[model samples]
Target: MSTGPVTIAVVAGEASSDLIGADLIRDLQRLNPGCQFVAVGGRHIKATGAELIQDNEVFSVMGLAEVLKDLPRLLKTKKQVVRTILSSKPDLFIGVDSPDLNFSIAKAMKKHGVPVIHYVSPSVWAWRPGRVHKMARFIDGLLTLFPFEVECYSGTGIDARFVGHPLAKQIPLQVDKQRSRAQLGLSDKKILALLPGSRNREIKELTPVFAETVRKLNTSDEWQVVSSNVSEAKQKQVAKLAAEQQLELNFVDDTSALLQAADFALLGSGTVALEALLSKTPMVVAYRISPITWWLVKTFRMMQLPYYSLPNVLAGDFLVPEVMQNDLTTDNLLTACREVINDPQAEQRMMQFHHIHQSLLTAQPDQAARAVLNLAESLC
Candidate 1:
């Protein structure tokens, strides 16, 4: 092991990964008091006292078309970040999600003999299994959030470990809906929580449709609509959109609290689906990427998974409604929302949600921190 304090360099591309990076940083601080951190991250990661070489906004774009549109800026940012991290020469480099950019950075840093640990395994098991072979060549250790992910790296000679997911620990096994509703000052009127998404592009694509669906669902005054906001900018955009449609929407700053208080969630496909599940809230997942990107994914036969949403993926069964791509219409969303809201087997689905939550509870606050430090010190 090194005689001096270890310096860790980390990069988290978007909001969810930023949360994971922040938690990992807190744990790292607890374990190695003198260690320092540098990163390319968002507000949450920056809050942990890590020196930010770059903001994560440039790397936040999703889909092939979306990335291509921002390619020039992303490439430039990546080059600058890689140069800076190499010059700093940290003891270990941890890439939290954003496999597209982080993988490139890891490859460059590994050439200079830096130990590279990737925090979230890319969706190799879901699609593009070829990536696992390429990952084995550069990543010294792979830290996965899900239990099944470790099996994907079999015989790759990469040190793969399941650290569980931080959200499993952060969100309790049982959430109190009445208490959450009370905290949000909400009345018990069968709330339907709307989560268009965190990104501006998603807000643009999903809000109008979500609002239209809510209008159709609430025609009989059977449901109260609550829109969950991630930031003030996004909240303002959603509020403006709601005004244009002349729709009434209640806004909440806290997503978990809204999810807990909600009777049903109509959300875009992402980490929020998992949040809804952990909160024991029933949901219908929906998404719409650029048309060209969806066409490319189909034309090339790139997608391998039978289901796209995390809840169904984990359960190995179709546990929720997924209205996506061409199927993501206002009518389709309304239909799915009604199906879940009035289903007789809702109790069975809730039990399955609890089972999945228990399975992901393997994480300790310091589990990932201890694993990362052990690998770094081993190479020292």
Candidate 2:
């Protein structure tokens, strides 16, 4: 007996999710050989040969204020997505990250008798534990990055699997610092990478602080700051900022290379933190958002982790200092950056980061792709 192609609908709402979704699609296709995919994604996902219904930009709001501004567009897109999925009736609906958008869409699609798999658990373990109940109602399975997240869905009887982070598997545990530096054309002198963020708004809010911090740090050491490019617009914005600040900066399309090249990194909190951790690069995490959005996040108590950086969070300690909101000032950021740069024990701490990196890698084949393939097989 021969099985028909398994149709999977995937929605990935951010750059990191786009990369992960693309890799997942490749693995799923490898397993079934004839699987079909359609949904909203980015260039990376498009490269995987998936039919794109919409681009991820439709649902890429970063903060509460931003979400509010884009609410009407988001709602319209959600309706369109629901209508499309209902018309097509895919066997599996894979929601890759973006809990706010994907979870709502999954909830609506569940009524059509499609299995909903939520990849990347929203931090219910950290805050708003009540979300688990809603997730259980809509999601058939939850694929988590961290092992600790599996317990969050236990009470709801939700099928949760700890598929170690894709980055942990993608990046090497011990990067050759000299080789990376040589690849990026940098001297053996102290190198500091500035990852303001991948989003335009993130660069606007954090780049100034990061630039100023670089200026402060430059007083002590000749540091080379590198910015990651997500778009031409962001690259131009960062270039302008770097020029205005009179800072020596390099622009790279791949942030992973920048992480590997740097001795330490000053980054905005998000996916890059995990990437840096996997590269075993010591970093200082910093972030800033609109005042109203900050107030809302604080009032709602959504952020529960003591540290924002993924390495520190995974290590269950303050492995890296997090300077957020008011603390994200140039002076404070410089202090944190300097501490990581000057500390003699910094390399030792990065070695510990390497150990954590190894622990998160798949023991067998690529766990991320295998996990998605397993889900696809079950649907078939």
Clashing pairs in 1: none
TM-score between candidate 1 and the true structure: 0.96
> On a 0 to 1 TM-score scale, where does candidate 2 land against the true structure?
0.94
What does candidate 2's lDDT look like per residue over 68-110, in tens digits? 8889988998899888877777888999999998988998878
Compared with the true structure, the alpha-carbon lDDT of candidate 1 equals 0.88
- Summing lDDT over every window of 10 consecutive residues in candidate 2, give the lowest-scoring window: 371-380
TM-score of each: 0.96, 0.94
lDDT of 1 by residue, 1-380 (tens): 34357788999988889889999999888778878888998888899999999988768788999989989989988999999998887888999998998999999989999989999889897879999989988998988888999999999988999988888888888989888899999987888898998887898899999988888789988788898765788898997887677678889888878998999999999889999999999999999999999999999988898789999999998999999989989889989998999999999999999999999876375788888877777664
Q: In model 2, where do residues sit more than 4 Å from their true spots?
A: 1-3, 185-189, 376-380
lDDT of each: 0.88, 0.81
Residue pairs that clash (backbone atoms under 3 angstroms), model 2:
none
lDDT of 2: 0.81
